[model samples]
Target: MRTDDSGALDLSDGDPILAVETLLLTRDGRPGGWRRAIHRADDFKYVFASNR
Candidate 1:
């Protein structure tokens, strides 16, 4: 998601996005503080969801 110029967290390198996705996909059972955090991309928000 594109952030406004003022007070924006720069994620142009995509590392933050990758890190968020990895954490969402690789966690074991039971939730933790990291899992409880809000993950977002541009204007889109993401959640840790499973088909099972």
Candidate 2:
């Protein structure tokens, strides 16, 4: 993920920061590859589905 200039998380105030327990990279619904979780502070979380 991306971080702001202040060194804090770039996510919004109300956004939930997922720990990225697992990552599945694929072109379609099928799993193409897997990525291990990296415990980096600079890493930002991403939400695929939004309630809004």
Candidate 3:
């Protein structure tokens, strides 16, 4: 999860990683089916997870 000014996105703080643990998330322990993985903003549709 590393990027620079040449990043594909139009935004960057010279940082490589935006959010960590991009593979899993858990707001509670009931929705075992509400966790997912992807690189983007919070969709709240499937719960985008992160980790780095």
Backbone atom clashes (below 3 Å) for every candidate? 2, 1, 9
Return the lDDT, model 2, position 12.
53
For model 3, residues 5-35, the per-residue Cα lDDT tens digits are 2265444554333343333435764433443
Find the candidate with the highest lDDT and give its number: 2
TM-score, predicted candidate 3 vs. hidden true structure: 0.22
Model 1 residue 23 CA deviation in Å: 22
Off by over 4 Å in 2: 1-19, 40-50
Q: What digit string (tens of lDDT, one per residue) describes model 2 on residues 1-52?
A: 4555223544554454444455575677777666644333446655588789
Instruction: List ranges where model 1 is wrong by over 4 Å.
Output: 3-7, 17-52
**Residue-wise C-alpha lDDT for candidate 1, range 1-52, written one tens digit per residue:** 3454222545444434422322333367554434322233455655788899
* CA-lDDT, candidates in order: 0.41, 0.51, 0.42
Task: Write the candidate numbers in order of decreasing TM-score.
Answer: 2, 3, 1
lDDT at residue 13 of model 3 (Cα atoms): 57
